[model samples]
Target: MSERVLVPRNRGFLFLDSHPAGCRQLVADMWQACPAPAGVLEGDGPVALVIGSSAGYGLAATLAGLKRAGIRGIAMSFEKAPTVRRTATAGWYRTAATAEIADTAGRDLVFLNGDAFSDSMKEQVADLIEQRFDGRLDYLIYSVAAPRRTDPATGAAYASVLKPIGQASCTKTLVFDDEGVAEVREVETGPAEGDDVEQTVAVMGGADWERWIDHLAGRGLLADGFATAALSYIGSSLTEAIYRQGTIGAAKAHLEATARNLNERLGKMVGGRAVTSVNGAAVTQSSTAIPGIALYTGLLRGVLGDGLVPPIRQLAALWDQLTGAAPLVLDDEGRIRLDTWELTEDVQSAVAERWETATTATIADLADLDWFHNEVQRLYGFSVPGVDYSAAVATDIPWPDHAP
Candidate 1:
């Protein structure tokens, strides 16, 4: 009983491996079509840690900070498990269906998988937040996307590329599968020579997000008004010469200068804040392994149709700019753009007029590549929606009663 197909790899998409009740019915139909986070908070809430929490936009900001700000999550991830010839990584059944839906809503999670740029996974997430989160954290969300990195004190490995910094360019790409848009080419890339933008800024910069906020702000486990963020992307200007001036935009401009030196050392030691945010352009899995970013996310989802804002509505507009519902803008270098409505100006002037008529016979009539192939088959939990993909299920599920 193993028929969960959709592989098309060369670093773009992969699935054929995942079941556990169809990845817990796509994480219970994405938190039953997630919503509740416009505003809500009533004391003793925040905890979150989330470093690359299993899947895109770090699993939608770790399920919008534990189902919309009732915070208390821990997450981390490297992924892949199930055996006897595979079936797991749909982020290990989306972290065992986010610990069986945060233990049936009595909310609390831990789920660390490993190698979160190791330092023994930051002292195993600061000893599981000092044995079950009382040692304090408030929020730290880094959202890593590895390709290679290994310098936990000079083990020196580093590898991340995706060329285009100063020469060969071109554009228009699509050619996907898993049943959708199998055409549209042009392609070129090639650049990022020599120390390839310093090994893709030592494998996607922000130096392991300032070494996990300097080891959770030196283990006194950071909390006093604490807040930290990382994710970044610049988009538009037609993937500015292969993504914001290439080499992963010089590793997102050294992760926006390591989020202004982690917001001036977590605001002079503990009034805390270290933002960066940015994000937009959806279909993740590290933006479909980037090369003209899946034809600019299928012409920016055909110019933001349904005002395109996935990644759980951009992590609920970044948890409504970290709970205030406003006043947390920042841009001219102070980062946090949150893709300000995916860079409006009429969504980059209707995606630069469908990027000069996208080709391969007008990309299925101008891009949306079937909503980028059903959002890469709903990021590999397989075209979810009340599941039941011919039921055969079970492939060793369990693991996540605060897994570690």
Candidate 2:
């Protein structure tokens, strides 16, 4: 037998793998470490399933929905690697943490590890629902994000490319290597052809969401009055050329369209409804991968640190709407409204103006780049409070439900 290689884990952080007992301890610690947000619910619900439910706003949404709706049981699907070799995705650690918390609370939880876009995965999920749940699901959340997806209709695999709307554009980005500020410029890296746009839309957009809903409904697995939701975002114009106005934006537009169709389909099913929550900007792994968003998010983080509304608070608010604690306001486009706050006239105006006037000496004052960097790091389980950074650690935490 060959010798096993040890991969380095993020020591002194919550990303470390904990065995079953350690996982349990970590859950209890986090519960005590963070206070429940104001107005959180403490009850039990019908049942909920959070797809792509491991990290970023999705994870937060899952927790908030459960806490507020009193959801008793949850079935989640997360695409993550094993922690044994330390090569696991960050979501692997996060799912472990979530499972530990749910178990400690006596909430019945079943976690599925696989690609949510796969048809066989849906069958497996349906079977799990029938066996573990009482053949019905009350709440469903679609939150998967992939750089590439195989189109069900065409059987073609397309990779999403992020680029500016027009000619080359350069912008300043925060550099953590340099103590305070540095100028990082980006140009359009790829051409977004018409077919590329359509293919990207088909793969990453709303078709998968529709398929999931149809599958559940056709199988009679959705309960009466059930609700399904998908989370979307529209960033500021500073980054919109690469995001909202570009290929990804086209995909999001399609996603919003799917929401309308799902609403009608669900309405005809059992008085059920479908909702799409246009969420606020946050420093997520996916967000970081998008060019220019890092700079935008860093600036927003600085602004937020100065007492502006944070993404977590915004997510909590979205959860409130999901649980009927708050009403969802819609824009003229017939979509749930939230992006306006982040891409507000005032906020966008400031970022755009700063982008024009910013230089190496002036970029720091243009926005809170430092704050954004810290928040971005925090999102990855780094720079958090109460965690020591010098501890020896191992990444081989065993999955409680993993069968050899």
Candidate 3:
């Protein structure tokens, strides 16, 4: 018998096949769904500078800006390139696929792969903007998720940790193996230790985001009437201790605070506005790493099935709000809320009820664990339908060439 080929696996995460066709299909569906305002100019559209624009909300926002606003974009990300032993990260293929579509559609897209937190990378992107797309950008999307960061000036490394604030808690967490077996494991998380919270804030917080905007503004790269949005999340009370009220939560609070600060500064300086777009939770590379998220997502699916909004859908809704299709609504804190429906009372009530009674034995019945599993794999570009898994794929793919 011929050897059976399976999706490549690393560290229990199955990296999806980066077949150009499958990537194209995913982009096409999202692009078609994004509603562009009528009478948008073809060649004179807005320009967007998207930081961390490879996966999840970043990728979705990029597609929406392109398809709906007819905007040109420059995407910056830090993703792994394919090695001799394995395929590239899903972001690599997703970016390549988006570039291919942009070419066929005669849209402008430029992707730069590097450390978004670094001063040099920011400088490079600024230079690219000034040289290629004039000296101004209309939109800046920040959606980076990373565990550690190195300060460019100080060379200090900070790592983010996931822990509750007050005390240790024992919870039921989900673990997936290479063969895709889902197992519930009991996890005990302790409180953040000395400097843990501050370190996490330093790494995952708004400082870097503020720095990026400042850099662009200093260089005259922000256009008049420009807008910038950062992605944040506030899930159900089930994850309050570990997520919404934990170290990460502190970082998010800082992010929102930064948004308000930037909103004031940008409005005064360049007629720009900054807002935090509170997002809904879905299976993504970052969420699965949370201790109890798999269980919660499964329960969430059982409640919000057919109504769960993925990143792509969420971005399209955001576009509508930006273009006035929907009212520009903000939470009491002045943050844009795309998670309105996800956090509705009815949805949370249902999820809470299921969450209260859910056990490992009862999870299979109360939650759509299978659906969550597939979605997790899909985040990495695996399990996508119509993509031939057995076909040989190119490990090395180049970015689309752009002329100055």
Candidate 4:
């Protein structure tokens, strides 16, 4: 009889597949990257709630605030894919690593898996906040991105669409070739329905943030001098037709407006303020998937690597503003503006010139293509230092503090 070989179950898809050692290593890395300042909140400090804290800039914000402020308790909501394959989102790995590090450091971290758009989830979250911290929260962060949302009142679903403002348009994009020059044209799909835009606003906008604040305040679970912030982005006009003028852009505008409303309402409660940080554009998982952006990002990455300002640098600056190291500047729209620095007149002019007169010969002069490709890879947790690619990673690897 032939001997049978058994294959280990693939569980990385369900969880982050994080090991205690890896988690510790990650914490050590992050600590070294951004060390805590003296006299900051320390030793089992204030509680922070991060909604949509699974991936992208949201995860980055969570890490930044946690490290800077020495926050000890964290509540996070993340949507995970249900599958048997090893497809853990980056946020899952980050949360697992954070929980492990916090446990060893004598901190408190709670992670909840739920749909943030649902009412039941909000109630449960409110209950958790009241029960855990004696009705007091110090900080709140809202960052959510979704393709579609169902209307609570109408029982109808809305799907967001990306397109130009007036009519159909085509744009050039990057393609893989030996010469690093290829043209991929894209057409604007069309405008989404008004209801669709409204639904998208409801799901991705500040409604959840407001709910969190209202519930916490009504329940007397908010600490003194609390602060809340949400992230916003305004891409360049070249891509704005498909981004800022589209359904998603409408939702963002609503989110920004909601932040002001919350600031007015929540400010009176605990001497608090609600602010929105205009963040930089990067090749995040969400941003890369948007049409025409990958090409622009590829170009931008190349240009920014040569002593030019990049979005990550902008994020660092945003953190400085949040920590009171610098002042935040606002535009006429009552929204924080950072994209102006990123898509400056000179930068956009240069990219436009390149776009018009670029060919195989012009591609080399555009910028370092290699840097652009690597940044995209880094977004997926690849090409990061300290990770061993040679060894086979286990899917059901145990986190340091995972109960099960």
Q: Pick the candidate with the highest TM-score.
A: 3
* Model 3 lDDT tens row, 1-404: 11224464557544544444455566666667666656654566778888888787888888877776766869878878766555567788788888877777677778888899899999998998898888888888899889999998899999999998889867777666776666667788999999989989998789999999999989999998888899989887878888888899999999999999999999999877888999888787888787777788888888878888777778877776765657778888878887877788888898888777776667777788788877776776656777787875555776656664
* Candidate 4 global CA lDDT score: 0.61
Which residues of candidate 3, in runs, are more than 4 Å off? 1-6, 14-24, 33-41, 177-179
Name the candidate, 1 or 2, with the larger lDDT value.
1
lDDT of 4 by residue, 13-105 (tens): 122332322333544465455545545564666677777664666666656666665554455655443136444454555566666556655
How high a TM-score does candidate 1 get?
0.35
lDDT of each: 0.77, 0.65, 0.79, 0.61
Query: After aligning candidate 3 to the native by TM-score, how far in Å is the CA of 299 from where it should be?
Result: 1.4
By descending lDDT, how would the candidates be arranged?
A: 3, 1, 2, 4
lDDT for 45 in candidate 2 is: 51
What's the TM-score of each model vs. the native? 0.35, 0.84, 0.93, 0.81
List, residue by residue over 180-256, the lDDT tens digit for candidate 1.
Answer: 54677788888888898898889888998898888877889888878888888888887788878888888988988
**Backbone clashes, each candidate:** 0, 4, 0, 2
Q: Could you give candidate 2's per-residue lDDT for residues 1-404 as a string of tens digits?
A: 11223222332222342222232333334345333546545544567778877766677665555545556545455544653344345566567777766666666766677778778878888877777778888888778888777755567787776655555445555444434335656444555756878777876799888888888778889998888888888877677767888888889989988888888888888888787778777777678777777777666654455545544455567656665677866676556666666666777766666666756577677667656655555554544555543543344443437221
TM-score of 2: 0.84
**Highest-lDDT candidate:** 3
List pairs with backbone clashes in candidate 1: none
Clashing residue pairs in candidate 4, if any? 135-221, 136-221
Minimum summed lDDT over a 10-residue window in model 3 is located at: 1-10
What is residue 342's positional error in candidate 2, in angstroms? 2.2
TM-score of 3: 0.93
